[model samples]
Target: MIYIACGAILLALGLIWLIKPAKKANPLYGYSSYLAQVNQGSFAFAQKKASLYFALFGLLQLLLGVGIHLLKWDRYFLIWLLTFYFFILFPIVATEKSLKQFLIKRHELPADYVDPDKVKHEKTKGFRDRK
Candidate 1:
Protein backbone atom coordinates (compact mmCIF):
# COMPACT_ATOMS: atom_id res chain seq x y z
CA MET A 1 0.00 0.00 0.00
CA ILE A 2 2.86 2.37 0.82
CA TYR A 3 4.64 1.67 -2.43
CA ILE A 4 1.42 2.11 -4.34
CA ALA A 5 0.88 5.42 -2.62
CA CYS A 6 4.42 6.47 -3.38
CA GLY A 7 4.01 5.55 -7.01
CA ALA A 8 0.80 7.53 -7.18
CA ILE A 9 2.61 10.51 -5.70
CA LEU A 10 5.39 10.20 -8.24
CA LEU A 11 2.86 9.97 -11.02
CA ALA A 12 1.14 13.11 -9.83
CA LEU A 13 4.41 14.98 -9.71
CA GLY A 14 5.25 13.68 -13.15
CA LEU A 15 2.02 15.12 -14.45
CA ILE A 16 3.17 18.49 -13.11
CA TRP A 17 6.16 18.20 -15.43
CA LEU A 18 3.64 19.37 -18.00
CA ILE A 19 3.04 22.77 -16.30
CA LYS A 20 6.49 23.49 -14.83
CA PRO A 21 7.15 27.16 -15.34
CA ALA A 22 4.15 29.17 -14.19
CA LYS A 23 4.75 32.06 -16.55
CA LYS A 24 2.09 32.76 -19.10
CA ALA A 25 1.92 35.29 -21.98
CA ASN A 26 2.42 37.78 -19.13
CA PRO A 27 1.89 37.69 -15.38
CA LEU A 28 -0.47 40.27 -13.96
CA TYR A 29 1.06 42.59 -11.36
CA GLY A 30 -0.65 43.84 -8.22
CA TYR A 31 0.50 45.88 -5.22
CA SER A 32 -0.04 43.00 -2.83
CA SER A 33 1.78 40.70 -5.22
CA TYR A 34 5.32 39.55 -4.57
CA LEU A 35 6.01 40.97 -7.97
CA ALA A 36 4.35 44.23 -7.11
CA GLN A 37 7.52 46.16 -7.83
CA VAL A 38 8.71 44.07 -10.76
CA ASN A 39 9.38 46.03 -13.89
CA GLN A 40 10.87 45.50 -17.35
CA GLY A 41 14.35 43.93 -17.85
CA SER A 42 14.20 42.49 -14.32
CA PHE A 43 14.51 38.96 -15.56
CA ALA A 44 17.36 37.96 -13.26
CA PHE A 45 15.96 39.71 -10.21
CA ALA A 46 12.57 38.28 -10.98
CA GLN A 47 13.97 34.99 -12.07
CA LYS A 48 16.15 34.85 -8.98
CA LYS A 49 13.28 35.58 -6.64
CA ALA A 50 11.04 33.10 -8.45
CA SER A 51 13.83 30.55 -8.65
CA LEU A 52 14.63 30.99 -4.97
CA TYR A 53 11.03 30.46 -3.94
CA PHE A 54 10.65 27.64 -6.40
CA ALA A 55 13.84 25.99 -5.21
CA LEU A 56 13.02 26.51 -1.56
CA PHE A 57 9.56 25.08 -2.01
CA GLY A 58 10.86 22.38 -4.33
CA LEU A 59 13.54 21.35 -1.87
CA LEU A 60 11.07 21.32 0.96
CA GLN A 61 8.72 19.16 -1.06
CA LEU A 62 11.48 16.85 -2.22
CA LEU A 63 12.73 16.54 1.31
CA LEU A 64 9.27 15.88 2.59
CA GLY A 65 8.67 13.28 -0.10
CA VAL A 66 11.98 11.53 0.42
CA GLY A 67 11.42 11.79 4.14
CA ILE A 68 8.08 10.11 3.81
CA HIS A 69 9.59 7.33 1.77
CA LEU A 70 12.81 7.02 3.72
CA LEU A 71 12.00 8.45 7.13
CA LYS A 72 8.40 7.22 7.21
CA TRP A 73 7.10 10.68 7.93
CA ASP A 74 3.73 12.09 6.87
CA ARG A 75 2.95 10.04 3.80
CA TYR A 76 0.04 12.02 2.44
CA PHE A 77 1.66 15.38 3.01
CA LEU A 78 4.93 14.23 1.49
CA ILE A 79 3.20 12.86 -1.53
CA TRP A 80 1.32 16.09 -2.10
CA LEU A 81 4.44 18.15 -1.51
CA LEU A 82 6.31 16.01 -3.99
CA THR A 83 3.64 16.55 -6.59
CA PHE A 84 3.79 20.30 -6.04
CA TYR A 85 7.60 20.32 -6.28
CA PHE A 86 7.63 18.29 -9.48
CA PHE A 87 5.55 20.89 -11.28
CA ILE A 88 6.98 24.02 -9.66
CA LEU A 89 10.66 23.60 -8.87
CA PHE A 90 11.36 21.10 -11.61
CA PRO A 91 10.44 23.66 -14.24
CA ILE A 92 12.54 26.43 -12.73
CA VAL A 93 15.58 24.18 -12.47
CA ALA A 94 14.89 23.13 -16.03
CA THR A 95 15.23 26.74 -17.18
CA GLU A 96 18.90 25.65 -17.54
CA LYS A 97 19.66 22.17 -18.94
CA SER A 98 17.84 18.84 -18.77
CA LEU A 99 14.54 20.68 -18.76
CA LYS A 100 15.57 22.50 -21.93
CA GLN A 101 16.50 19.26 -23.63
CA PHE A 102 13.24 17.63 -22.63
CA LEU A 103 11.20 20.61 -23.68
CA ILE A 104 13.06 20.90 -27.00
CA LYS A 105 12.39 17.26 -27.74
CA ARG A 106 8.75 17.49 -26.72
CA HIS A 107 7.99 20.78 -28.55
CA GLU A 108 6.85 22.53 -25.36
CA LEU A 109 9.38 25.33 -25.45
CA PRO A 110 8.75 29.06 -25.18
CA ALA A 111 9.31 31.41 -28.08
CA ASP A 112 12.23 33.97 -28.08
CA TYR A 113 13.63 32.56 -24.85
CA VAL A 114 17.24 32.09 -25.88
CA ASP A 115 20.12 31.16 -23.65
CA PRO A 116 22.04 34.21 -22.44
CA ASP A 117 25.54 35.00 -23.68
CA LYS A 118 28.70 34.78 -21.58
CA VAL A 119 28.40 38.52 -20.98
CA LYS A 120 27.38 38.51 -17.36
CA HIS A 121 27.17 42.30 -17.19
CA GLU A 122 24.76 42.56 -20.08
CA LYS A 123 22.71 39.73 -18.73
CA THR A 124 22.68 41.31 -15.27
CA LYS A 125 21.68 44.67 -16.69
CA GLY A 126 18.88 43.17 -18.69
CA PHE A 127 17.60 41.33 -15.68
CA ARG A 128 17.96 44.35 -13.41
CA ASP A 129 16.09 46.91 -15.43
CA ARG A 130 13.21 48.64 -13.54
CA LYS A 131 10.93 48.84 -16.53
Candidate 2:
Protein backbone atom coordinates (compact mmCIF):
# COMPACT_ATOMS: atom_id res chain seq x y z
CA MET A 1 0.00 0.00 0.00
CA ILE A 2 2.74 2.43 0.85
CA TYR A 3 4.61 1.51 -2.26
CA ILE A 4 1.54 2.09 -4.38
CA ALA A 5 1.05 5.54 -2.91
CA CYS A 6 4.69 6.44 -3.39
CA GLY A 7 4.60 5.23 -6.98
CA ALA A 8 1.51 7.23 -7.75
CA ILE A 9 3.04 10.36 -6.33
CA LEU A 10 6.19 9.87 -8.37
CA LEU A 11 4.22 9.26 -11.53
CA ALA A 12 2.20 12.41 -11.02
CA LEU A 13 5.32 14.46 -10.37
CA GLY A 14 7.03 13.01 -13.42
CA LEU A 15 4.15 13.90 -15.65
CA ILE A 16 4.19 17.41 -14.30
CA TRP A 17 7.90 17.67 -15.01
CA LEU A 18 7.54 16.40 -18.56
CA ILE A 19 4.69 18.74 -19.27
CA LYS A 20 6.38 21.88 -17.95
CA PRO A 21 10.08 21.63 -17.33
CA ALA A 22 11.80 24.36 -15.39
CA LYS A 23 12.69 27.26 -17.67
CA LYS A 24 15.54 28.67 -15.62
CA ALA A 25 18.27 27.41 -13.32
CA ASN A 26 17.07 29.14 -10.19
CA PRO A 27 18.11 27.47 -6.94
CA LEU A 28 14.50 26.90 -5.96
CA TYR A 29 12.85 25.16 -8.93
CA GLY A 30 15.35 23.46 -11.19
CA TYR A 31 18.57 21.48 -10.91
CA SER A 32 21.20 23.68 -9.24
CA SER A 33 24.93 23.12 -9.54
CA TYR A 34 28.03 25.03 -10.56
CA LEU A 35 28.19 23.31 -13.94
CA ALA A 36 24.51 23.71 -14.59
CA GLN A 37 24.66 27.40 -13.73
CA VAL A 38 27.63 28.10 -15.95
CA ASN A 39 25.42 29.73 -18.56
CA GLN A 40 21.86 29.82 -19.85
CA GLY A 41 22.64 27.09 -22.37
CA SER A 42 23.89 24.74 -19.70
CA PHE A 43 21.04 25.67 -17.43
CA ALA A 44 18.35 24.92 -20.00
CA PHE A 45 20.11 21.83 -21.22
CA ALA A 46 20.54 20.48 -17.71
CA GLN A 47 16.91 21.07 -16.81
CA LYS A 48 15.55 19.41 -19.92
CA LYS A 49 17.99 16.56 -19.79
CA ALA A 50 17.50 15.97 -16.08
CA SER A 51 13.75 16.20 -16.35
CA LEU A 52 13.69 13.60 -19.09
CA TYR A 53 15.81 11.23 -17.03
CA PHE A 54 13.70 11.96 -13.99
CA ALA A 55 10.45 11.17 -15.81
CA LEU A 56 11.72 7.88 -17.18
CA PHE A 57 13.20 6.82 -13.87
CA GLY A 58 10.02 7.83 -12.12
CA LEU A 59 8.03 5.52 -14.36
CA LEU A 60 10.44 2.73 -13.55
CA GLN A 61 9.91 3.43 -9.87
CA LEU A 62 6.15 3.11 -10.28
CA LEU A 63 6.58 -0.25 -11.96
CA LEU A 64 9.03 -1.48 -9.37
CA GLY A 65 6.75 -0.51 -6.54
CA VAL A 66 3.78 -2.22 -8.11
CA GLY A 67 5.82 -5.31 -8.87
CA ILE A 68 6.96 -5.58 -5.28
CA HIS A 69 3.42 -5.36 -4.02
CA LEU A 70 2.08 -7.92 -6.47
CA LEU A 71 4.91 -10.31 -5.73
CA LYS A 72 4.40 -10.14 -1.94
CA TRP A 73 7.92 -8.89 -1.31
CA ASP A 74 7.15 -7.39 2.07
CA ARG A 75 9.67 -9.68 3.77
CA TYR A 76 12.40 -7.61 2.17
CA PHE A 77 10.84 -4.28 2.94
CA LEU A 78 14.07 -2.52 3.81
CA ILE A 79 15.74 -3.57 0.58
CA TRP A 80 12.80 -2.43 -1.48
CA LEU A 81 12.71 0.87 0.36
CA LEU A 82 16.38 1.49 -0.29
CA THR A 83 15.96 0.53 -3.93
CA PHE A 84 13.17 3.06 -4.27
CA TYR A 85 15.40 5.83 -2.99
CA PHE A 86 18.19 4.76 -5.30
CA PHE A 87 15.80 5.01 -8.21
CA ILE A 88 15.09 8.60 -7.20
CA LEU A 89 18.77 9.46 -6.69
CA PHE A 90 20.35 7.80 -9.70
CA PRO A 91 18.79 10.13 -12.23
CA ILE A 92 19.85 13.26 -10.35
CA VAL A 93 23.44 12.09 -10.03
CA ALA A 94 23.64 10.94 -13.63
CA THR A 95 22.24 14.21 -14.93
CA GLU A 96 24.70 16.29 -12.94
CA LYS A 97 27.62 14.19 -14.11
CA SER A 98 26.47 14.38 -17.68
CA LEU A 99 26.19 18.14 -17.47
CA LYS A 100 29.65 18.41 -15.98
CA GLN A 101 31.15 16.46 -18.86
CA PHE A 102 29.26 18.57 -21.37
CA LEU A 103 30.53 21.80 -19.80
CA ILE A 104 34.08 20.52 -19.95
CA LYS A 105 33.72 19.69 -23.61
CA ARG A 106 32.16 23.07 -24.31
CA HIS A 107 35.07 24.80 -22.70
CA GLU A 108 37.43 22.80 -24.88
CA LEU A 109 35.68 23.96 -28.03
CA PRO A 110 36.87 26.92 -30.12
CA ALA A 111 36.78 30.41 -28.65
CA ASP A 112 34.66 31.59 -31.59
CA TYR A 113 31.76 29.56 -30.28
CA VAL A 114 29.47 31.78 -28.29
CA ASP A 115 26.44 31.13 -26.14
CA PRO A 116 23.67 33.20 -27.71
CA ASP A 117 21.62 33.08 -24.54
CA LYS A 118 24.37 34.62 -22.48
CA VAL A 119 23.40 38.00 -21.13
CA LYS A 120 25.11 40.89 -22.87
CA HIS A 121 26.56 43.66 -20.76
CA GLU A 122 26.41 47.17 -22.16
CA LYS A 123 29.38 49.51 -21.98
CA THR A 124 28.74 52.56 -19.84
CA LYS A 125 29.99 55.78 -21.41
CA GLY A 126 29.57 57.80 -18.23
CA PHE A 127 29.00 57.35 -14.49
CA ARG A 128 25.28 58.02 -14.89
CA ASP A 129 24.98 55.02 -17.21
CA ARG A 130 26.45 52.78 -14.55
CA LYS A 131 23.60 53.58 -12.18
Clashes of each: 2, 0
Model 2 poorest ten-residue lDDT run: 108-117
**Residue 108 miss distance in model 2 (angstroms):** 6.8
CA shift of 32, model 2, Å: 1.8
Who wins the lDDT comparison?
2
Candidates in order, TM-scores: namely 0.31, 0.70
Mind sharing the TM-score for model 1? 0.31
lDDT of 2 by residue, 51-110 (tens): 777777777777877787789987888777666677767777888777866877788333
Query: Candidate 2: lDDT over CA atoms?
Result: 0.71
